[model samples]
Target: MIKVTDALNRFLFENTPVRGNAVNLSNTFQLALNKQNLPLGLKRALGELMAASALLTATLKMNGSLVLQIQGKGILKLLVVECNSEFGVRATAKYKGEIRDDQTLFDLIEHGQFVITLDPKDGGQTYQGIVPIEGNSISAILENYMLRSEQIDTKIWLSCDGNSAAGMLLQKLPETMNQSTKTDDAIVHDLDAWNRIGHLADTITDEEMLNLPIETLLHRLFHEEDVRLFEASNTKFFCSCTRNSVANMLRMLGNEEISSILEEQGKIDVNCDFCNTHYSFDKIDAAQLMVSDVAAQSSKEIH
Candidate 1:
């Protein structure tokens, strides 16, 4: 039975230096795609990315958010998904021209770039990694990035069927020195174990990934090996956009820009691409923003 829904399950191979995560997004996936009018193929792609983002976020030890983006120069211009430490996920996509149902990843995104950014919730320096798009699917591209850029041997399998999105990730942990010494024999053993478990995981079919319960799936894959499954972490669709955030963004545009926009459009209208939430600012709101900014500046100067 598929007991896990909109949750991530972490597991470890007790005897080997390998760890893995599995994520299945149901209502969360549907809610994320509800606001967008994406093509079928692009919708599936975005769903896969959303699942992948959650899986990647689970691997991080930081207290912030992880953003995965694929920007292309072809029909599919941009695909972005963000997952926070709490497993809150949001996704958006932009595409120009027609995207056919039969088009594959390479066919839609022709000269693309994959970028990953880590934004800490607390005041800290953000880190980002950029690489040219590699591989044909989102799973393959991310696996390539994990191996080449992050220098971690990673394997990812992603599946999205418009309604639900699911993914599984297996990673080989770095060798640790036990008993004050590291030897070639230990390294060789770790390598052999890693390869063996990876091969077992490779046989999982997409149907199983999307349909099987976490316990059943893991047992089927690693029943022969000693594995320990951790408690599942809940995942949900969440958008962090608010009217105040939109106001702050407008404040950044300065008085002149805000005035110009207000004049041309009568009122400044901003719609969040992720959730399709609308925030409108009229002349009064714009004036209040400038007034608040001036008052804050005056207070700072006086101190």
Candidate 2:
């Protein structure tokens, strides 16, 4: 199989109690935006959020999706990013008022709760955590959440320049966290290694982070340590919307609501916000949908 150029990478310090993830998004980032016009600040925020979400998803052992959402009460009305186990990603943003290009990512948000949701693909139990907005940048907000809520010492750096997005994460684990067999001296060395590595990572400029390839970037940052790079996972821009999903959504609107819309408009037209795909349903389609739902419900009852 062909390798994925835009990918997620995992690396480990062989002798240190630290692990890291770096993601570079090029075509995927542009595809995710998909012609949705947004302000400069909001676009920057969305790009960083997408990169961060992809990195966090790689850290999990989940065959599902991780969603990052920010409900803003200011110029940036809202932002959402979702990354799945297979690395399929999609995002959307909303805003009002004027957003200056010079505004910081945090400046767009007056107040909001940061929410992280883990949704299993196989109908497994979902988990969600909401935290107060404590940090300014997307990187800072995620780092704060990991440290406070997940009890992990995580440092994240993310940058996006409309065309591409990149993010790097450094996580410090306790000696016992991984159940490693090491002497006290080794453990002490691990602690020191984390400090040194974090410092090195900090020295990486945004220009290098956004332009350098992941392998070159890793080698440059951790040349002193024995770094093990894992197989890269493919990533792409994908919107998980289909005609059936749209039908189910319409059913949830109830028959009375559907009739009102159909009677007034002659046909019901729906659009997917993430992908901008259009779907239209006429009266005949609506009737067929009702019949199909009844048949599906009856089959389930029989089973």
Candidate 3:
């Protein structure tokens, strides 16, 4: 089994109109590191992205997926993670040269744009927001993006070492308490609840985030507040690439290009970047795939 202890929890102030989320990632970080031979710096960066992606996904009210990508011309060329509403996760990173031994975010990806793409699986158009890299930490950059692009008051705290990565998010949901609600009513009735909630999140330490279970961590953070915790969701390292997916790409390339590859390289070899799994098709296998492709095309025409 893929042992990923990443959990996402949605919480409400039970009596208040404010809502929040806290996400944890530990083994998930190790799983991503285990898949590729990444440098210490890149590994740390990837872990931050993993945790950030999870936190971002957990806040989605719509049934869709979010993809977090950072692209630049510096050492850390690319970092990407896709998280669906179901909490399924996968990631990939590309970089060149020695990731400075004691590198920070700026040291690695000099100038980049952090992008979040929302893909609704129910056949709707995807939306993307691009934000310039504004801060040294991934959390800061994301917080800035949320405020500047989405115009929502948001605060994020993310921390990661070589062994594990973790984060917390406090967002202002769209809701208003009934007019009868008053500050003298209860602890949750105050508008300052969002700031106070963020203060609690700030007290969370990296060790707690990396080791403690979600239940323990949440209780520790907001013990005094009336928190409504949702069922924890599971996250894992999953890649959607397969030999058949590669074959579909070959069909898209058309027969001439496919034949040219066979004539030159003897066989077509494809490797999935997400998992580093390789798929090779010999000339006969390639020809059979082509025949099936033509039949599918003919059937579509007949229909």
What lDDT does the true structure give each of the candidates?
0.88, 0.85, 0.78
Deviation from native of the Cα of residue 187 in model 3, angstroms: 9.3
Model 3: per-residue Cα lDDT over 181-250, one tens digit each: 3343663456687778888888888887777776677788889987777777777766778888989988
Candidate 1 accuracy as lDDT: 0.88
Model 1, span 1-303: residue lDDT tens: 647799999888765667899999999999998989888888888889999999999988899999999999998889999999999999999888987888876797888999999999997899999999988888889999999988988999999888899999988876551221346565556658888998999999989999999999998988898778889999999999999999998888888898899889999999999999998888999999989888878899999
Query: What shift in Å separates residue 240 of candidate 3 from its native position after superposition?
Result: 1.2
lDDT of 2 by residue, 116-154 (tens): 999998889999999989866778888889988999999
Report the Cα lDDT for candidate 2. Answer: 0.85
Alpha-carbon RMSD to native, per candidate: 2.9, 3.0, 3.9
Error of 3 at 147 (Å): 1.6
**Model 1 TM-score on a 0 to 1 scale:** 0.92
Off by over 4 Å in 3: 1-4, 176-189, 254-256, 288-303
Error of 1 at 152 (Å): 0.8
Q: Where in model 2 is the C-alpha error above 4 Å? A: 1-5, 176-185, 291-303
